[model samples]
Each structure stands twice: as structure tokens, then as C-alpha cells.
Target: MKKTLLVFGLLLAVNYMFSQGCSDAGICSINHGFQSEDKSFKSTLELAAIYSLGEADVGYFSPYISYTKRFSERFSFTSKVTYSTAHGSFGTRSQFGDAFLIGNYTFKEKNKKQWSTLLGFKFPFTASNLKINGYSLPLDYQSSLGTIDLFLGTNLHYKYWDFNGALQLPIVNLNNNSYFKEYGGTNDFPSTNLFERKPDALLRATYSLKTPNKKFTFKPNVLFIYHLGKDSFENIFGQRENIKGSDGLTINGNIITSYSLTKQSSLELSLATPFVVRDSRPDGLTRSFVLGLQYQYSF
Candidate 1:
């Protein structure tokens, strides 16, 4: 167990340096660079639900679902959907939904992980409606912005630790034009341009410790995110002007524990905290606390 813990700790250190070094150039943000890989031609499902409570904000809820299936030892595909809604005393109530698809590939043999790559495409079908102080908005405000995304990513895993990252680029940005014209309600609204570079990169690293029974494991992870681009979140309802050009850094750490219930079943729990945040929007919402639970079954 001590050896496992040491290994994971080293991985975490490496991830931290990798993320920080990106600012020097020729390096990528950690969020989109490093991620774990599961190489089974099997199906994995995830269901996430979250609720936030605060001052006048009252509360907000989000429910997300994803399904992933591997076609071969090193090839896989995934699909996901998310629904979110919020109500506030500021006389604001809104709801939004999105759907996406992704594909993944591994270059190494098994989990050796010299290099693993993932390429994906996402088609977003978004529908949203908002009301402030009990007043109706324009029709375009309640419609969908048809758009697509292209993503490329890689992961490097050593004996005791691993690094994962990815980059997401927009391929079809029709949604931006539609949103600006509809939400901005002005002919001078910004135009959708694909040549712009957006900050959609991520990186993460984790180390693991095994218990004497081998059935129990503990893992600590660190994560970072960078949002780049001029109009990245523009047109998105509720987004503040400060969030634009608001490129900075955020760091989060999580500790996860897993206990084996049986050869085919296991229970997992995680606790996390946002340890660092830079240039965070003053009005932006930050995660205060997170709790995770998962059950696994194999056939």
C-alpha cells in the first residue's frame, strides 16, 4: 500500500509541473491532455446529479448521463446528455440541454500506456428558455443552436502514475451566429468565426495506493482547466462580461476510495476541494463541495 501511494504521489507531482509548465509555451493545458483509459470492449455507464444552494440564487440542479462502449481492445465510442435548470430571486429562471458523441483509441499494448489517443466529434443540439422578472423573451431565445465540435486528446501512463490531456476545437459554429442574432437582438451582433482559438484544454494526474487485501484502494488526483478565446462563453445566457477574456487557472484535488464488495461488485466514494483559482469571475459560481458514489457490476 505504501508503494502504491508513493507511485500515485509522484504522478501527481508530475501532473502539477506539466500543467504549470504549459504557460512557458510548447506545453498544453492539463485538463485536455491527460485522462484515464479503460480498454475493454464493454459498456460503461455514468449518471451524475448535482444540486447547489446559496443566497438569492436559491438553488440549481443538473443531471447528466453518459454511455461508453469499446469496439475493440483499443477503440471505443461514447455518447452523453445533460440537462440543467436554475431559479433565482433575481427573477431569472432558465433551462438548457446538450447531447454529444465521442471516440477513443489506445496506441499502447494493454495498460502500458506509452501513448493513447482519443479523437471525437460532438453534435450539440441545444434548447433553452429564460425569463427575468416574469417577462417573456424572443422566440430565438428559446431555440436550438445547431453546432458541432472536434476533439483530439492523448494520455501517457507510466508504471505507477499517468498523465492525460485533451484539446477541443469547434468545427461548426452555426450556433454562435444564431445565438448572437437571437439573444443579442441586434444586427451588430458578433459573427461566428472558426479560426479563433478557444481555451478548451484539460489535464489531470492521479496516484493510487493499494491496501493489504488488494481489494481496497486509495487514489488522489489533481485537475486544471483553462478557458481561452474571445467569445468562448458569449451569447450564453447568464454569462457575465468578466468571464470573457477571463483566462486564468484553477486547481482541484480529489481523494477517492474504493472497497470491493465482491469480485464483480465494488463501491467507490470521493471527496474533493478547489484548492486554487486565478482570475475567477467575481460573479462566477464555484464548487463548494462534492460527493461521489459509484457501484460496478461485471458479467
Candidate 2:
């Protein structure tokens, strides 16, 4: 009975790691301890590929690259870029997505407790207005959300656990051109004209574990995101109407596993899925599941 229980516990941990996907805007991946304290390298570069299935059978593929530079023991900066391609029943579209620039500063450190603060910006590449044959596409089809956002967050770490909180606020709204009314009965789409998205508040907690041999690391995490206000859309009369059931909470679970290849290189896999979703997700951020593979090298 003891041996059987041990096997069952191991299996459970592995299964829960792949339960959900990671799409918490940009807060979840920052400050994940990619830098090595024992090594002299102060910079790291990462390349990643991600795949996810979205609403209406839409499939998305994104390629990502990021560079992190540690200026000091307590301060660092990261820059990231991504390109995305999406296809579904409506059509196919591809473009450069958003970019993120973040800075982190460690404020307090004790025996086993540490605290850090982060400030970041998300910039869009386009006007969030993609079209097909003169008709505007929905949010799901556009590669960029086309909104400038500011992120204010902080992190607390104690022993093998971490807690994070952040707020993502749209400073500028450039997503006003998505008009999905002209699908011509062939496709039943949501109303997303001149879409206005609200702010998002997030909270997350995670636990990290390492193998006895120190070659593999497992981190299981849960995330909560709450839409702060109702989203709105422009109608035919140029009046903005609030989208019903747009503000609510979404819960997601994720597991990240990494294998150390060398002193300065590693491979990581991340899987995520939603445990609970809101009523309306017209922003097209809904994903049935997300899988990501990443490679990192430090110098």
C-alpha cells in the first residue's frame, strides 16, 4: 500500500502540471529566476514557441523572443517580442503582436523572504484593425490588441513559494476598428465594433520543487484575473454600449517544468488551462489549452 500511494502521488503531480495554459497578459513570466547567482553571466536570451486553441475552433501559433539584462544584483530589465498567426472558420491572418518592456527591482531581502516590484509597458504593433476583403475582422483574428497598457506589480517569495499581484490598465485605446457585422450570414460572429477593454487585476501563487539530482525543476501555479469594468462597443449610431457579462473573474492553472542542459542553458515546457471562465470573453483571449516550449541561454 505504501508503494502504490507513492506512485499515485507522483502521477497526480505530473498530471496537474499540464492542466492549464499561461496567458495572464505579461505578469506570470517575469522574475521566474532565470538568472544564476553562482555564475558570472548577467544576461539571458530565450526563444519560445506557443500553441493554443481558442474560441470557435480557432487555432493560434506564436513565436516569441526575449532578452533579460541584469544591471545589478537587485535590478534587471527585460524586453520581449512576439509574432502570431491565427486561423479558423472565418479566415487566416498573421502579423506582429504586442511587445513588452519591463524593469524589476528587489527591495527587501531576509533569510528566506524577498520582495520585488515590477513596472512594465505593453505596446501594440498595429491599430488592432485587421480586415478581409474590406470587412473588419474580430478580435480573435487580429494579431495585436492595439492598446497601450501599463503594468504595476509586485512579488513576494518565502522559502519555496511565491505570491504575485498586478494591475494592467489600458492607457490608450486604438482598438476601435473591429466591425464584425458584415459576415453576410455565413458566419455568426460577436459584435466587436470599436471595442473598449477594461483594466485587469491579477493575483497568483506558486510552489517550486527540484529533483534530488538537481537536474529537473517543477513549478505548479494558479492564477486569478478579474476584469475591472464592463467592456463597451460602438454601434451603428456611434454610441458606445456596455457589453453584458463582460466583467468577471477567471481562474487558471499551469505547470512549468525545466531541465538543465548545461551551466548556462536549459529547456522548459509550460502547459495551462482555465479552471473557471467568465460569461463573455469578447477580447478573444479565451483558450481551451496552451502549450509552450522554450530554450534559454545565459552569458
Candidate 3:
């Protein structure tokens, strides 16, 4: 089993795999580009449910809602809120994932090409507590990192293809308050522990097409990522589970389809899976499949 540190002070110290099930390193569940400047404002609400499993674990279920609004020809804003419930050999825990927000601006355009940059942040908000079985759960199992992070992103487009990337860097470092607690005042730990995390980055590209009849649109995406590592709590005997290999490379592919139910309503579905992996993943953290569905309307 390879070991490494997590980023929330590593991605929360988070990956939803949109991404928690698929990328987890903070790549969007759905790539929303610096779309063509059009409407004065547009809103999208997406509901996504995804599942994943590793070699040693059985499964995780994460359901979430995301909203985006384009305020003008060059600016847009987006946010995502999620709840994750994990099951299998590790037991069960349902907690709120962090809330992520982004503000994007398109700064350049030429013919059919456009470029934009973004700034983003994540907040520590949980729907449930972090500790389970009287000890702090590992980073992957918890939702919020209990700190704030900053994001920088850029997007470039040509014809029907989009190239985009982002960097997630934590400006604050703090650990769980319930990281570990002692029994009846034995060799003790605190209700809260302090930990440090780093940054994670992603690069992605895609090509899209529409049916001649204007009834359906399809997009295929490719994403690559490298997340930094760190060390955390020791085992029951106070041995830092420091095994190393927390950082690595991952390649993913996804196909997205949309069908219009009307002028203002539509149905969307997608499938994303990682087909390539290199280097040791921390604690057997392998790639899994993610399927999603979303309903959208605009006013």
C-alpha cells in the first residue's frame, strides 16, 4: 500500500471524484467552458449522483447540486454543493462536501476562438460531523477540509475544441477538531488536530458536435491530473501512516449527451472513467467509474 499526504491542506485535504467519483482532484464534474458570449444572463442547475469503488473498498455514493449564472458577455459565476455517503469495509458515513465557487471572465476573442481566466474558492460546511467510531476519519472519507483554498484557471477554445486547466492551492492550514481523542485521559490527543496540505492541478481538453437536425449535442472529454501529497495521523500505536507515494498521474475520458425537452428544458447524461494510471496511488486509491444525470432550465 502506497502512502502520501492529502491536499485540503492536499485537493480538501477533497476529490468528488464530478470528480469525487471520477477526478476528486477538483476538476469539474462537467466542463463548463468560457462559453460563447451570448445571453445577458443564464442559469443552470445540475443534479448529479455518482458512485466509485477501490480495490480494498466496496463503494461510495455522492449526490450533488451545482449552479451557474452568466452575468454579462464576459463574466460568469458558478458554485457546487455536495453530500457524500460511503459504504463497504470501512463502514458508513454521510457528510457534506465542501462548497466551491468560481467567477470567470473572458478576456480575449478572435473569430471562433476565445480565452478566459477564473478565480475560485471553497468553504468548510458539513451536513454531518467528521468523526466516526470515536476517531477522526481519514481525509477521503470526510467532506469539508475545514479551511479555505484558492483556485486559478484558464480556458482556450478553437472551433469545437476546448482546452482548460486549473490549480488548487490552499492558503490556510488546519486539521479536524475531532481528529483523535483519548479515552479516560490516557496517552492523549486533542479534540482538534492541526495538519498541513498542498496543491493539486489538472489539464483537460474536449471536442464537441451537434446533430444536423439540431436535436442532440455530444461532447467527448479528456482530462489529466497531478495532486500533491502529505502525511497525517499516526496509527493506533502512534505511528504516522507514512508510506509515501501520495502524488501521481491519472488520465480520464468522458462522453456527455444532451437532449432538448423544450426550448427552456433539457435532459443530460454522462459517463466518465479513468483508463490509465501511473505511479503508486496512496492507500490503493485507484480510478473508478462515474455516471451522472442532470436536468436543466433557463429563464
For each candidate in turn, the TM-score is 0.64, 0.89, 0.76
lDDT of 3 at 81: 85
Candidate 1 weakest lDDT stretch, 10 residues: 20-29
Using lDDT, rank the candidates from best to worst: 2, 3, 1
Model 2 TM-score on a 0 to 1 scale? 0.89
Q: What is the C-alpha lDDT of each candidate?
A: 0.50, 0.77, 0.61
- C-alpha lDDT of residue 52 in model 2: 82
Per-model RMSD to reference: 8.4, 3.6, 8.8
lDDT of candidate 3 over 69-123, digit per residue (tens): 8887778898888777766544677877778888888876789878888888877
Question: Which structure among the candidates has the greatest TM-score?
Answer: 2
Model 2 per-residue lDDT tens digits across residues 1-299: 34643554464455444432223555455545323243377988989999987876689999899988888888888899988899987678899988999888886579888888888899999887887777678887888778998988888888888888888899998886656555434444567888898898888887778888889988777889898988888877778888887788888777788999999999999877777677777777777777899999999
